[model samples]
Target: MTTFTSFTFLLLPFVVFHVANAAIFDIRNNCPYTVWAGAVPGGGRQLNPGQSWSLNVPAGTKGARIWPRTKCNFDGSGRGRCETGDCNGRLQCQNYGMPPNTLAEYALNQFNNLDFFDISLVDGFNVPMEFSPTSGGCTRGIVCRADINGQCPNQLRAPGGCNNPCTVFKTDQYCCNSGSCGPTSFSKFFKDRCRDAYSYPKDDATSTFTCPGGTNYKVVFCP
Candidate 1:
């Protein structure tokens, strides 16, 4: 009985560690149309309207992003292109998707054992999105449900998405490559529509949000 108690005690920490560091991401498509959901470490999934996909993400994952690809055509082998958010023409994205896509960016178990997340339009906007925490008592959520696509500026309009000024001009002013930049008229256009989203590269002050570690998240398209 003593030996069994010792073994059980040793296992407790492992179970606690696993539960405290892992997160589940539920991605859903509420759009009237189909959406190809893309994630860096989670790969990709075809989500028809009302469909959903779940992903298990490990602790300490950084620079991770989730987004939706529209108007994609994949072959039997999962090789294809998307009108927006194409990641090297592969259904299972091995890298970040191309621009003109709304983004859900996150970092898990960072400083202070907190999870950081945000909805970003720095790459651009294609679909409406809502990113929220479903667990860990995190109540705040972010959303970008603007008509940016239909009202996209002429220079930034793409085939099936609204391109960011950086994609159209590629200048440091729009890209913030020099590490010193601020909002522009173009960034304001996006910020005005979606106040919760990161309209520019340095929009951290208001755009970024935090939750306690082990928080599960839900990302919904057209929410």
Candidate 2:
């Protein structure tokens, strides 16, 4: 009996390690229209209003992002372009999508066994989004629901989305290429609208959120 108890105790840490290294992402489209959802490691999916796609992401995944591609038209071979967030005209993205997109960025099981996440408008805003932890007792949720497209500045306005200043001007002020820049009027415009989102490259103080490792997450479009 004592030997069996010792074996169980030894197995417990392995189970915990496995659980801490994996997560399920529930991607949902609550918009009034259809959207092509894009993810770096998870590929892409077409989701109509109320539809959803679930993706299982492994632990230790870094620089992962999810976004919605608007006004997309893919053929039988899953090849097409999107008005925004187009990833090389492929339906299943092999890489990150183009800008004028609202981003849900995450790195799971990172420093101190925590999951770091944020909603970023640094690429620009194409859709309203809500990113939240659904499990692991994490109650923090970040959202970017402002009407950024309608209120986009003239220089940043695009056909179906708003462009970031960096995409427009490509200057160190907006792009932070020098890595020693601060907020500009353009970045402030986004920050004013979506206070909880990353307006520029260094908007980390209030924009970033953390959850316990292995926490499941939900990314809702038009939420």
Candidate 3:
């Protein structure tokens, strides 16, 4: 609930550009329970077992986040709240999700015509998730859909999720607010399990990944 910018410390491996890029996302939830999937730019939807949602992200969208909310109850008007990953207490999130949630992050058509993408646990995690570039010549997929909840540290454990160090402790040591922070035992806990995701600030060098421009992505929940 603190004021933190998502993917603020991310540094694109490609150069900056003006031309826009477009892509489609197939967000599928394989979990038995229903998940309220939310996105900053792409909107929100509910996915039940064996169900999926799709969205076409227009060119020029940046810093987009796709995440799932748990323990949510919505009314007919899409007005409601969630126990985890709640975005301003709404079913359709035009905003960012709360902490203690797993995140799929991306920026399309960045510098040098490359698209940057990653699965981020820096916000903590409620559910396991995978982010994969489906097309545009990407061979690697990013996933953090690990059983972190069952093994979450006592201090970091929340009602339905694990809290990132920065969210739970809110200290310079974990937050890297002074831009001097590095990996700690907590971040190591995440990195050890999800090697490709960002465990903390300054994790760009190895955690961030790139694909060619115009690449489509698939975000799978409970994968």
In the order shown, what is each candidate's alpha-carbon RMSD?
7.9, 7.6, 5.0
For each candidate, what is the lDDT?
A: 0.90, 0.88, 0.84
List, residue by residue over 1-223, the lDDT tens digit for candidate 1: 0000101123366545854667999999999999999999999999999999999999778788999999999999999899999999999999999999999999877666677899999999999999999997899999899999999999999998999999999999988888889999999999999999989888888898989768999999999
- What TM-score, to 2 decimals, does candidate 3 have? 0.90
How many backbone clashes are present in model 1?
0
Residue-level lDDT of model 2, residues 33-79, one tens digit each, is 99999998899999999999999999778789999999999999999
Tell me how candidate 2 scores on lDDT.
Answer: 0.88
**Candidate 1: misplaced stretches above 4 Å?**
1-20
| Candidate 3 segments whose C-alpha is farther than 4 A from its true place | 1-21
Please, what are the lDDT tens digits per residue for candidate 3 over residues 62-82? 788999899999999999899
lDDT, model 1:
0.90
TM-score of the candidate numbered 1?
A: 0.92
Would you list the clashing residue pairs of candidate 1?
Answer: none
